[model samples]
Target: MPFFTVIIPLYNKEKYISNAIKSILNQTFTDFEVLIVNDCSTDNSIKIATEFESEKIRIIHHEKNKGLAATRNTGIKNAKANYVAFLDADDLWKPHFLEKIFNLIQNFSEARIFGTNYEEIWDETVKMPHNNSDSLPKDFVGYLNFFKINIKQGIYNHGSVCIHKEVFEKAGYYNENIQLSQDLDFNIRANYHFKLAYDASVQMSYFMQTDNQLTRSSIVNKTIPNYDAYEEWAKSNPDLKKYIDFERYVLGKRLKKNNDSRWKDMIAPIEAKNLNWKQNVLLKLPSSALNLVDKIKLLLLKVGVKPSTY
Candidate 1:
């Protein structure tokens, strides 16, 4: 049984950390080490983690709060296993998570990274039969370059990902410069050299809450898939250039980044609650008196305020 390093990059997620750690401990395949990177959490998350007192559990704390990407990089550096896996503090994986993935990787050792389906839990809703299938759509490689289908269609989730340690080292660690879309950039960078795979058997749960998570304010901050990173990935993807429409999309994002005009260039994910116009205006919304206008607009819109299209 190959050992796996389960890395969790945490930041003040006291309310959720115990549950996240417990989920991994409960896994059917227990041959794993849990590395919790504490990015200067103000909450009692560190205390709770320390109380575990398990040799298998290691905690690395930063004096100052570094963001998610940097924290994960820290965990990666500390990892001591052939395989590296990641779990966000807010998500949960099934008991068979590691067992199933291990079997798949044992069969397909050539694949550098693998991802599985996740049950997206939000607003009292649970999307079941989450794991779709293993085969990437025949044209998936094209989408892999710049996310025309995979990201937009929710074909995979990052929470259920596992990759080789050497792959992480060879491809370079996650981009610390990226605030919002570091995952996208890292995956794109990894894809350049690694053979990616999807296993529908492994299951995880993504609890979508209206808290400090990246999804909540992605549009306002443009971080989920950072427009800047998006532009960089799009322009550099040779495969995307082959498809005329995708080529245009890549060029558009590239232009947006070049001008630093993400306000006009980046489009929020369709599933995001924040509307296009709202995100556009709120990006530049000042924290002082200027926010009152946006607050009022949000309130009025919720109360059925509408006007003819300008």
Candidate 2:
């Protein structure tokens, strides 16, 4: 069996699919199979993926257009290798991405989850901010501490993560109900059941496409169920409720940016004593005032200034 089953979820990423597949083919570690889960793309994404002549590549088409969560779950169920790695069709991986992850597994043999650092590719001109650790840490022990570490510094990108297949049997597959932050949901479940390790070197490329991206459309359409999903998960795990409340504050900012009034109801201003000064103040503002705040923030962004957060 192959050492890792690389699962690439494809939608309408025709422009970037070739490079994504090529990156996998060029990996320094070669004991792997590429499982391309095409979620009924209407574009040439499928054509580009199938053009790869490598025997390691295989394509599976969804009869209907399933969302990201279902597409990922499909790939996990069909993965043949002992470990599964996720790489979005628009993302790229360094030649040693898999090799480094394999080394981490060998170093921390007791760990079930492993991932590497990643860099975001915005455009040809601007450089994306770097927020990764200088070096990889030893295994992270518990879910609560690990979640806090993620809030302070990102734990890992989905593209850079490699999970042992057994974890899925215990933690269950990705929730198919959520439209956005599905990867975070899966990681929360997996981390709760398994120990985690990471390789700090940047090894994955996260493309920040200006258009044709899910985040772009999801923002306007109100489909991201980030708050609800996390709140549901937090119900059974009381210790993690604080983290879910934290998500509420972050989501409030996002909804305010979109001029979305849904943010008002989603946040409980009375029970939000845990929030910082700025967050609490924002939550107290009326919906109309929130839009004005969004406009001011946008003006600040254009002038290269951002509101300070606590």
Candidate 3:
């Protein structure tokens, strides 16, 4: 029987670690190992995982409070199977998630990295899949097609993705420096050499527990810009330039953070695509005139306008 090596990096997840561990232990695919790296958590997460002690469960202890990326790296270093998967301490895997991916692994035979759909739950509500997380190709090679669109299909839920051990040998480990977007950065780097398998069956029930009314707002403040995690990865992988128009985009973002020369440096590579409608007189009509134009465009689109096509 084939097996997967699942790595769960636990911090202060005393509140949710038990459920996350139990969900993995209950997987329909039985041949696997679960390695829990207790990242110097200040809470009872270690006790919670220890409660699920079995021959299949192993724990790696990080004596200091290293951030998520380092803790996850510990798990990767200790992984003992031919394949690896990750689940965060605050999430629960749908029982069949692994079985689905493992089946696809056998069928595709050539797949190196693969991911499944998951539900993002917050305050008992499930957020719809990303506005751009759509266009889920039903077969292997989905990611190759996705790369053409550039930074769009970031479907690899850290909790629901699995990769052959060879993936790391090829793409390397997650950048420990990036505070956020580490997984996103890792996936983009991985796709440089690996083919991704898409199967909607890999579902995990996720919960966002933060002290905020809207989770999106909390993420932007707490994680999004803590460090330019994705930026470092993109800089290293120049191939991503087509998909992430990062340099030109800095112009539209918080203008106060951007300086003129930095903005020009970004626009230099793709100056051909820099068509500024904001500076054009015809494009900047009165508000009422613009509203009327928008309405007419909608009416024409009611007839037809090409979709970017998911």
Give candidate 3 misplaced runs (Cα > 4 Å). Answer: 130-144, 149-153, 209-239, 246-310
* lDDT per residue as tens, model 1, 1-310: 3389999988887888889999999999989999999999888988888877478988998888879889998988888888889998878899988886787677776787876656766432434433232345422221133243342324556678888887887888887776765776676667667776666543788875323221233234344344343444446663432222222233333334334455344433222222234433434443343334434534443444421110
1-310 per-residue lDDT for model 3 (tens digits): 2388899998888988898888988999889999999888887889888988788998989888888989888888888888899999888899898888887788777679877766656444434343233454434333343354334334557887888889888888887866656765676667767877777643777665322321123122223222233456556655455444532343223121222233334334442333333423322244355434435533443333412211
Itemize residue pairs with steric clashes in candidate 1. Answer: 180-223
Candidate 3, 137: how far from true, in Å? 6.3
Model 3 clash tally, residue pairs: 1
Candidate 1, RMSD to the unseen true structure: 8.1
- lDDT (CA) per prediction: 0.63, 0.73, 0.64
